[model samples]
Target: MSVDNRRVDASPSPAAPPPPDPGAAYAPGPARPPGPASRLRRFATPVGILAGVVGAFGYVATFDPNEPGHYPVCPLLGLTGVYCPGCGGLRSAYAFAHGDIGTAFGANAVAVVGYFLFAAVWVLWMVRAGRGKPLRIGLAPVYWWGIGALLLIFSVVRNLPFGSALAP
Candidate 1:
């Protein structure tokens, strides 16, 4: 006897478990606007960060780094007679805090740039905090490596005769 080629059971599949109640699972939706207390709590971290930075700048502004006894010398400069990228950072900060932009740049242009960068980042962080949104600084590995390379190049150039301007 010839066997039937077609299958006998042609029933439709069961309905998919009512497409799992989206509400049941924790699906991220628009974040609830923070209340006054919650918003204040969020500001606490950014404010603390600002306070710490201001305190540091205040200390640097008060204590003169140009005085030999106040700040320690860069170990690299002391040992290898090489000017590190951060060799004049304290002096730069001192001049920057005192509103002497030219001297700050002369002390260390990169450090002056760093101060501005910090200010920009801090402002952005404060803005995000005020808006109840988390500030995210997600830099790629390449960017970090590039920064390292730039510092290295700056150090090397400052030590060279032609790059005397970069020296502290």
Candidate 2:
């Protein structure tokens, strides 16, 4: 018998079956495995952050900022004969750690404040991480600008002869 090419085979056949339902065909994909990279990141990030905090405080505990050469000299101060705002931070931290608040303030009031700020922020970060939440601070544009201006002023002041006390 000759087959009719023009006529369509509309009827469902006994042997050949219809395609499965789209909904039924899709089984929920198996829960994705926690990949190696993600696992590494999860463990590494928090520990690194914590280690940094501890290392900072540890340096403050062990070293006296008043003494020279424990920390590296500020290249900016030496090279340009100008004091950067950060010149005496390590010494300030050492003073603050040793309960010589007056000396810390004399060394660098701003760095002392920064050390406390870092401690507080790190505590907040640890608390949030413990609760399975990430800690993030997004300052407003005005605040950022203000911070920049403050740093600039500090740099300028520390370099001036009258601001010698603020210098290292």
Candidate 3:
């Protein structure tokens, strides 16, 4: 066969690379992320929130809210005999502490809902902590408004004779 000089390649071999330099490597080393403890510090916000919740629950449990002088009086109650949104929270907590389900529900249906809410939030916090995700309260304004409206309705319904069973 006759030689074809035009087909000769000018580029280096595809399989071979340039020799490594005697100096520092140009390739970056893997970036090691922070460990759990360090990551926890970075996530101080969620930690603070969780601690506050635990402390609040502990305080409520240790000092029964039903007992007078443990907590400040509800301003709304002093102004009117009517049941405010938070009127029966203390009694409901006390009932919950003593395992009196009927009393708990009677003290405040809304508070019973609060108890479940607290439990769900606590569970989520624990789960997110395990996964190294921050506990974020991303509720929409509309959802918060819905909660407020629900409480207002709860307050009104509990005060009425029809919803007397809801009263403490």
Over 4 Å off, model 1? 1-37
RMSD of 3: 8.7
What is the Cα-based TM-score of model 1? 0.77
Off by over 4 Å in 2: 1-48
Model 3: per-residue Cα lDDT over 1-168, one tens digit each: 987678777997787666888796687768899666655564565568778866766667788877778888778777787878788787787777668878888888788888888779877876777677767989899999999899889889988999888777
Candidate 1 on 3-72: residue-level lDDT in tens? 8899777898787766667569676878898565587887898889889989999999999999989988
**How far is 39's C-alpha from truth in model 2 (Å)?**
15
Candidate 2 global TM-score:
0.65
Which residue pairs show collisions in model 2? none
TM-score of 3: 0.64
lDDT of 2 by residue, 86-136 (tens): 877777777777788888888887888887787798778766666656678
**Per-model TM-score on C-alpha atoms:** 0.77, 0.65, 0.64
Report lDDT (CA) for all predictions. Answer: 0.90, 0.77, 0.78
Order of models, best TM-score first: 1, 2, 3
- By lDDT, the best candidate is 1
Model 3, global lDDT:
0.78
* Residue 22 alpha-carbon offset, candidate 1, angstroms: 36
